[model samples]
Target: MEGGKRGDEAGPSSEKLGELSEKLNEVCHVGEDEEDEDEDHRSNGVAAGFVPGPLVSLKEQIEKDKDDDSLRRWKQKLLGCLESDSDGQMEPEVKFHSISIVSDDFGEINTPLPVDENQIGRVLFTLKEGSEYRLKLTFSVLHNIVSGLTYSNTVWKGGLQVDQSKGMLGTFAPNREPYEHTLEEETTPSGVLARGLYSARLKFEDDDKRCYMELKYSFEIKRQS
Candidate 1:
């Protein structure tokens, strides 16, 4: 009779223990799934922080193309300046950095002045054909001023007028803002190009042609070279 009672008690205890084991397994499975989701979320966050290699390459390529385009346009402008004008009557208004007149062959005015009255006599002074003895006149636009405006500058050398302009700006227009002008012309001692004390009378004029802000500058014309 004791053995029968003990068997009944064992059957109830075994059933309770099996139920507890199943509950513990379910809890462990749920915890493992949650941990896997957290790990996946961390991997996704890391990927989002990094830019793709292809996208970075594309951005670099775009910048290079833009730089190339700018360089090409600049080259075109320089080539155009060296070419003759389409009308064949206008002077090529080249860009310069400073204001001075110098000879290509004899060097600058400070070297040694050319003594020949008809220096390089064989080479005639003609705008159509170039000459070895050339005058490079460089000047820049004054700051705080706009284009399409005329500035007066009367230049005298050897008591003869070299530059007498009612509108010194002429028909030339600036290629860009803060432009400088370089005038390269075949020169001779004849007319007003003879060497002497050079003087210039510069003035800015109003719309009514009234001159103001008058300035005078003088430079020696003797080049020893």
Candidate 2:
């Protein structure tokens, strides 16, 4: 009788173990499915637009069809006003000089690159709610050509994402002069509820998905006095 009772107890224990094992498998499969979905989403997002071309050395490109006068002129025109003494560069380099917020009400507020350490975590600037503004970026390309350079900005309020933007800066060749790009105009959301501090991340990347820079900053929207 004791042996039979022990077997009966063992039967329920084994059943519980089996139930736990099935639950664990289900959880693992769910996690894997979510990961796969995320991968597919990322792949589809990139494939939908702006596929980067293969990296080619600037020297090789300059050497191609050297004898063709028309092609040479065309290349020169395409690559605007390159430095006469510029050496053949193997890879591209980008240097961000500054960013400016331009608005009719506020004029312009310029922030220099590599923000000061003391200013880190501090509010960079404040904007009046409902005001329209445009962002201007000044940068320079050095060495080789930069292809499909793009900009992205994401803003969050109270740990929740509120806005996102992406803009294509286009391909650029090394030049002595800096390039200035003004983004499309945007109006700040207006409301008592919208007046608050917000955190943002700005990123610059190329067609290869190589990140040139990423900056995190905070700003505030205030009610107009």
Candidate 3:
């Protein structure tokens, strides 16, 4: 009788263990699904045909065709007021000042760069659902020319990537004044299902695939109150 009782007790314990194992498997599958989604997103980006070129200094380029007056004049026009002697610096450097969201209803909301660590994961701003908006980035370039400066943004909701976008901001030469580039307009997703907090990563890179800055932040989409 004691042996039978022990077996009965073991039965409940075995059932409990089975339940726990199933729960663990579900959690692991969820994690794997998220990883697969991220991998697919990366694959799509790689297929976009962005190939980084070899890095060459502006001074070396200018010296290559010293005898070609027409080429020299064209280079001068392309580089603006940049003096040829100013190529003393080695690699290009970019410092972001601020990012602003412009909208017809909300006007403009600006956020200064180098966000505090404490605020990194916090919601920086809220947007009205279905509202059209544009992002304006203000930054300064120093040292050498930044070739093929590009901006990319990826957004996620509930551990699932919802959107991704990339655009070229063009090459820039060192300048005393900051340059402002406004992105193409975008409309926020509408409806009750779209109203929620979303996380996003913004990245800035050059032709050499050198990342200048990366920022992770959150925002909320709400119905206009």
Candidate 4:
């Protein structure tokens, strides 16, 4: 009976050892599975602290699309300014009358337009004495990077001169119906005016019942011939 009881206790110890070995095998297999998964991710260029290559390409494409849209908008604005008129139609014909120069003693002179700044001359203009065009003239002096609005009138016949040295900045007059007038210089000196490319800007506007037509002309200053 003593030998049999010892054998039975030994049998329980052996069974317990077999169960522990099975549990250890299961733990090792689970750890191996996790390691394999980590290796697969690294091989595909994706890691815990990395960005994917495809995501960078998508960002560049989005920036390119934004630039293309901005360029299209700028083109549309420029076309509107050039092609569109008051009634959203193309502009029509514009005709401007000729302007000349004259002096009191010499009458109508043949001098070139835009005489020298200090040349002491006059500009003669002739228009329909009483017309319904409501034509108006404006004289502008541009010199030394400055532009000054000198005179404005609607006379039928007149002359004009702009001189900064003699204090005769700019003046106009009505001499005769389709005649000449002299633009005199001032004896007193006001101040020194800058000298450079100067111009006379003329603007004309005529309105019909539907839409209006506006025209602009610029005459530059030139040396005496």
Report lDDT (CA) for all predictions: 0.34, 0.68, 0.69, 0.24
Candidate 4, RMSD to the unseen true structure: 38.4
Candidate 4: tens digits of C-alpha lDDT, residues 1-225: 122223322332343323321211111111112122242244332345544221112112222223333322432332222212223222222222223333232344243323345643233232121211112222221110111112221111123334211111121111112212233321211222221222232222211111111222222222222
For all predicted structures, in order, the TM-scores are 0.29, 0.73, 0.71, 0.18
Top candidate (lDDT): 3
Q: List the pairs of residues colliding in candidate 4.
A: none
lDDT tens digits by residue: candidate 3, 34-101: 22334235442442466644445656554544444544454555555466456656667899999898
Candidate 2 on 117-176: residue-level lDDT in tens?
887656877899998989899999887777777777788899988888777777777777
lDDT tens per residue, model 1, 120-176: 212221221122343333433221112223445566665666764433333222234
Where does the lowest 10-residue lDDT sum fall in candidate 2?
23-32
Worst 10 residues of 3 by lDDT: 23-32
Ordered by lDDT, highest first, the candidates read: 3, 2, 1, 4
Q: Considering summed lDDT, which 10 consecutive residues are worst modelled in model 4?
A: 141-150
| Model 3 whole-model lDDT (C-alpha atoms) | 0.69
Kindly give the number of clashing pairs for every candidate: 7, 0, 0, 0
**Model 2: lDDT of residue 96:** 93
